[model samples]
Target: MKYLLSNLKIDINNKIYLKDPESSDLGKRIIEHSIQLIDDIGFDSFTFKKLGIIIGSNESSIYRYFESKHKLLLYLTSWYWAWLEYQLVFSTTNVTNSNEKLDKAIDILTRTIESDSTFAHIDEVTLSRVVINEYSKSYLTKEVDDENKDGYFSIYKRLVTRLHDMMIEVNPNYKFPHSLASTVLEGALHQHFLKNHFKSLTDCNQKVQPSDYFKHLVFNALDTKT
Candidate 1:
C-alpha cells in the first residue's frame, strides 16, 4: 500500500491555496513547518509570521502559497481526508462481503493514526492530531457557506458518501445511512478528542478504542451482526 500510495498525490482544492505547496521546496517547507508549528502552539496562536521565522523565510513568501492561516488549515484538513479516502478505497476494494467491507471502512475511519512514509515532509500522525484538535475551525466560520460552494469540503463530503454507500450495501432497509455515515466520521474525531482531553467523558481508553465503540454502534443500528 505504501508503494502504491508513494506514486500518488493527495489532491486538495486549488482555491484553498494561492499556490501549490507541493510544487516547490519553499512551499513544501511552509507546509512541513506549519504543521509542526501549529501542533506546538495550537491554531489560535499560529501565524504566518511565526511560521516564517521557524522556516527562515519571509512572511510574504508564505502568503504566496496561502492567502491566510485559515486557508492553510483547510489545505491540511482536506489533504488528511483525501489520504484517508485512499486508504478506505484501497483496503476495501477487494472485499466481497458487505459486512466485512463496512467493518474495514469503520476501522479505517475511527482507528488511531500512524505516520505514513509516503509523504516524508508531512507527518500524518501529527497532522491527524491537528485535524482532531483544529478541524472544526476550518469550517466553523461565517465564510464556510461560500467555501463549501467553492468545493473546499468536497474531499470530506466524498469520504462520508463512501461510508454512506457501504452502510446501504450492508443494510438496504436502513433509513439513515447518510446521517449514520457522517456520525461515524465526525463522531470518531470527537471521541478521540474526548479520550485525549476529557477522559472522563468517554469510555474509550487503552483497551477500548473509538473504532470498537463505533463498530458496535453501527452494527446494532443497522440491525446486523458484527
Candidate 2:
C-alpha cells in the first residue's frame, strides 16, 4: 500500500509538477526529514512512506516535491553540497593570514567530523556508495563531468585547492598538491567518522573524539616532508 508524504502540492521543476516557489519550503523540510530519518534508521531502510509519516505528510504530497525516492536523494546530495559551501565560505573568506586560514579550515573540518548535527551520523562508506551510484549514471549536464572527481570529490578539490594556496603563502617551503591535502582530509574524516559508522569499525574504545584526531592529522600533514 502507498502512503502520503505531504498533502501540499510542490513543483519539482524538470519533473512531473509545475514550478511553484511555495513548494520550496515544504520541499526543504521534506529533505531535511529524509536526512533525519536516514540517521535514525539506516539509509537502506529509509523510504518515502516513512518520511511522510515522520513529516506528517503523505506520499502524494511528497510527489509534489519529488517524483521518486531517487530524485529526493539527488536533491539531498545537492543540499549537502550547498551546506558545505556555507561552511567553507564562512570558515575561509575573512581570514587574513595563510596559517590562520589553514587553522580555520582544519577547525571547520574538525567540527564537521565531530558534530552529528552537521553530518547526521551518516558515514563515509554509505555516502561513498550513494555518490558512486549516482556518479555512474549519465549526467544530463556537464556539472558532473569527471567519473572519479565529481560530487564530494569536486567539493573537496575546491576546498583543498584554496587551502593549499594558503599554505604556500604561509610557508614558501610547502609544496604539495591540492589532491594530496584533499585526500588527507578525506582520510581523516573517513577514519574518524565515516568508517566507524558504515564499516562498524570503531577507532577508539569509547569516547574517542574526531576533533582530537583531526588536530593530530593536521599537524602531521603540515609538518611532514611534502
Point out where model 2 deviates above 4 Å.
1-23, 112-157, 171-175, 194-208, 224-226
Q: Estimate the lDDT of model 2.
A: 0.52
TM-score of 1: 0.99
Could you tell me the lDDT of residue 49 within candidate 1? Answer: 94
lDDT of 1 by residue, 86-113 (tens): 9999999999999999999999999999
In model 1, where is the ten-residue run with the lowest total lDDT? Answer: 114-123
TM-scores, one per candidate: 0.99, 0.59
Tell me the lDDT of model 1 at 43. Answer: 99
What TM-score does candidate 2 get on C-alpha atoms? 0.59
Off by over 4 Å in 1: none
| CA RMSD of all predictions | 0.5, 9.0
The numbered model that scores best in TM-score is: 1
lDDT (0-100) at residue 116 of candidate 1?
Answer: 81
Each candidate structure's count of clashing pairs: 0, 9
